[model samples]
Target: MPISSTRSSASRIPLLDILKGLACALIVGHHLVFYGPMSDVAYPLAPDLMDWLFAYGRMAVQVFLVLGGYLAASTLAPQGVARFDSPLQQVLRRFVRLSTPYLAALMFNLLAAELARYGMDDGSVPAEPSLPQLLAHVFLLQDLLGFEALSAGVWYVAIDFQLFVLAVAVLSLARFLSVRWKAPWLAPVLVLLGACASLFYFNLMPELDTWGVYFAGAYGMGMLAFWAGHSTRPYRWLVALATLGLATLALDFRGRIAVALVTALALGVLQASGGARHWSPMPALQRLGQMSYSVFLVHFPVCLLVNALFNQFWPTQPWANAAGMVIALALSLRAGQWLYQHVETRLVSMPMALRMQGGLLVATGLVLLGLKAL
Candidate 1:
């Protein structure tokens, strides 16, 4: 079944937006204060009060991952009036919707980096990325090959993109399996597979980093929620299971188990909130959700620029760092609004075909590659 692009007519839940907004702000706060204080240039302690703040701050990224997966699945999965298209079409639509904003952001960040480099007098030449790496960024293939990260916060985008692909695959497989086998147990099996995968990645592949496995579980959980969202029955067992999962998270169980817990929590939230149909009225919260993506993308650069300026001019006062972060966040939020309104808004809704977007991506990659050779 094909999911419709047309948004549901239910009154949009402002709380979702608020959650997104706060989540984005948390990410900015994490990058600005948490990582900074941990680095040698900032804080010396790792697990003390400062360290604890950073640790908790980092969880904001995790929140975004969980929320994003939930939202993506909610929007993309087959639903009312959503025409069922081939898997290829599903994949293409995802690509187009995701990649366009990414491309715009990448270009903007690169240009900003270039400007920063030009203004610095430290005699440190910024290392120019290889053309291949640049192309990879444009194509959202950097993570697939373990290449360089593109934007400051783009690693999540890469994860999201990959999971989106997997979602399509999983949905198709689930549909096929349901037809051939028992239909009632398909969701449970998927939930089980996700649990297994999370454990395998968390325990066995500790070197793979928390971002990948964490987001994958979140995305899978989102898919689960999507499938169950339309159900009319009370899912008492599901609620109990999700509660157990969240307990694992609160207990500091990292990796697959933890990811599962977070995913479950997200599903629980959506369920409690009425599955996007009857979420409580929280206009401010809704605004946050709407700006969450912008917050995610814009914060890193803002912080980086602020740090650079601080390093160049003002002596490192903790007060200055605090002020810089506050200022950067305000500017970033304001800029995000403008960009979202003028650029992303227009581009997202344009009668743009995925094929053309693909071609432009290829051309952009080639151009970057040629620049590397120069």
Candidate 2:
């Protein structure tokens, strides 16, 4: 059999973007149903379909976490130590890339909420925000520290940020151990062992204030997939074993099966598609994939705004509610894609001096985790 090849390293592992986009869309639908008319302060009307979509919509976030782990692991490994840039620089880059858009979304949500109240109150002028905790919101620590999220969709960003830091450490350790052991495979093996330890720790002990273990495993798996894809003969056996494990996880054995299954499947996707691109003649999905972050961030506020506006006007039209939701989702995705291309893409490439900033972030995260334990 002829193995597939690609010009771009990213093209070799194509499923991730698709999965991420799917997750974001599911989240949008989920939030629409979740915070629709059922919410206490919801507008007087929302679509009846909200109840139906709620359950299915809830699965998107977890899927995203699993996907995050797989990608983090695959993307962070050094091409060569001699050509290796500092890991800290990479970490800082990730932080800024994720944070800038998140902050923008937060601001938009804040402004939208204020304007919403004004219009709802018959134009008497909106009340000021009592949720001043928006101050801590940008750091992605609010959710873990027991504060409500500053924006509706920010909890996942918090999760991603936490996972990113853990991933850096995990990859760094893998690199260090590889050098000490004098074997290339040693690093990957240690990473696998570490993943198992994390899975066990998170499942049984569960004492850490943060859920970094699971995230670490997932992101590390992604990195592994990336490596396997580049190899002449990838680890086909591991993929098979992971697939079986995933099937068992789907059976619900109450043994962190879901995590194992999700982790496995995520890696499997990367492994199988490692050499191939799921190309399409039509580019709609590629566009969606590109705008995924924006879609994920902006969807919540759109839903919230739609809910408020719909209730004020319709008061009880379920069909109209659904129609409005569809429209808002479409418009939100388009806007998100536009912003991502114009604003986020450029910001993502901004130079950060890697040595100090990335190292400090990794140390800070570890210190924070240790403090949580103590």
Candidate 3:
């Protein structure tokens, strides 16, 4: 049976925005506790809470991976077949969308780190970046190349890109086969089987965690949920997808997989019931979700700055540290709003943007090299 296409709409989904807002908050809290000395001071007061946030807050990223797949499917190939003229072009477009804001954030963080260094000594300050390291980051290969990250959570940016490219490639290949053999089911079936293989086999191997295949299981679950929610027999497809996901988990239990499965299922149910479209309007949550990517990109530097200020001024007051955390969160949101407005929403031609990014990368690398020599 052919999967149904999602109804086209310009309005953003409230449920999705709410979820993204929540995820961004969790990630911000996680970093607040994990990266800075503020957490150390507060740990004596709320040790258990601090520990929990430090440990599990990072898992919130699974929500993003799942949501990304769902939205990618909704936008790129709603009927479970590639619609673009070239998958490469689609990938390039996504790369530009992600990279522009990312490069701006990186430069901002670099400046923040330098300023923080003059204020006090702290672990939150990243080491001065080398030319090679900057180049690796420009290409989104820092983690894979074993170079130290200049900022927290930047690895996810690279991983997001990888997962997107992989998804497009898989769907594009399936589309090619379907066209060649004149079998519509062939595309969906092949894609589904590939997802299963990812869940059962590739996800089981930890060594591949840096690559998209490692997270393809979770990402694929999102893709499947999108199709299932829009399918003619929505319940049947949802149950089938859930059963497959559960079976994979049963074979090799993973905490992350459990989280991903639940997230995907929740998204599927929401989409199927029209709940995604009809949720009570929340302007605050909607705004947060709209700027979630910008928030994710810029929050770390804001946190780092707050941590430095707190350490230099208060040093030992728990209340001061707590207050700093609140201030950091507020500033992060404001910064995100500004970034989204100025950098993310601004229109630039793809070729021009790519060229600008490439030029900036070379200039930054040269400056880093000159600094190393000095």
Candidate 4:
């Protein structure tokens, strides 16, 4: 659901961006098919294809998870040492940066939901949000608090935040332990052990899905990829990564984990082979990748609106609905482009980000009040 960029263009990896673009496209398609009436109407045309997408499209999220980890490691601790002065400050900054655009997207989603309610009586349109629900989303605690997500894939945002915080904490702990033990290798070793624990234990528990530890293995694989890419013994690191992932699957096979492991390993291989550094940028793909976060944030609202239109005016016509799906996708990209340019790319200050969050809460109140009156 996310990514970061701190490196200069000259230092950036083209392949990662290209992969992100592809993964973002898959996630968008997954939601388009999984959520609403468009896919339902078009199902008979391609039952197998629709089913396949419904079942596996979400695996793209693992790609994002690995990518997020890779980028986070490159920025947070490229050399496996904590670079920031304060973990709290770094975490808070990440929260602010994430929520600034997120809150705006939520506003669009809330409005779209209301509009969708009038157009279709389907389950895809979210129910009117309560105060606690709105607040949960504002604080990125919706999943932990057991609130129904107001939009598709928002859980990933909360999970992304949790993963980042977890990463920061682990790195800080590793730094402390390294100093205390007088062993520089402890940082990477501790991280590796933690990732193994997550894969072997925490990741297997469905009840812990809302927490960072549940997804730490995939993210850790990404972090390890960074270290491996830079290490002289890249093959050893790659073998260790593959062994851990494969062993986890041997115990309990999860296709998502497989995707994550493959993504991480591929990234490690690319980084090790210098492909990551020398790859030529595909302009279209890289652009899509750069704005993929915005695409992820805004696509739901665009999808809702398109689905509503088709449901209200053109119910159950296969070709029309399929084409509407295409239109929705195109509109989603356009909306994402607008959002990336207008709201997401802007450098929001702490004070302004706070105000935006406040605005989100206030807007949600107004919408709920309107719903009640109606």
Highest lDDT: which candidate? 4
Instruction: Name the candidate that leads on TM-score.
Output: 4
lDDT tens per residue, model 3, 144-205: 99999999989999999998988888888888888889876665576578778888888888
Error of 4 at 305 (Å): 1.0
- TM-score of every prediction relative to native: 0.76, 0.75, 0.93, 0.94
lDDT at 52, model 1 = 57
Model 1, position 133: C-alpha lDDT score: 84
Candidate 2 local accuracy as lDDT?
Answer: 0.58
Output the worst ten-in-a-row residue range by lDDT, candidate 1.
1-10
- Candidate 3's C-alpha runs over 4 A off are 5-12, 355-374
Residue 157 of model 2: what lDDT?
82
> Which residue runs does candidate 1 get wrong by more than 4 Å?
1-12, 34-50, 76-83, 118-126, 182-188, 200-204, 210-214, 226-229, 243-252, 255-263, 266-282, 347-374
Evaluated against the true structure, the overall lDDT of model 3 is: 0.84
In angstroms, the error of model 3 at 371 is: 11
In the range 1-374, model 4's lDDT, one tens digit per residue, is 01112221126678888999999999998899998898899888888878888899899999999998888888888766777889999899899878888888998899889888888888889998887998899889999999999999889899999999988998889788878887666667877888899999999899999898999899888988877766767778889889989999999999999999999999888877755676756879888998999999999989999999999989979999999989999999999999899888888778988887787768776886787688
Residue-pair clashes per candidate, as listed? Answer: 15, 11, 0, 0
For candidate 3, the per-residue lDDT at 355 reads 80
* lDDT of candidates 1 onward, in order: 0.57, 0.58, 0.84, 0.86
- Per-residue CA lDDT of model 2 for 77-181, tens digit only, reads 533111235778877778888876766666566555554563354222223334445545656777566676645667668778877776666567766766787
TM-score of 1: 0.76
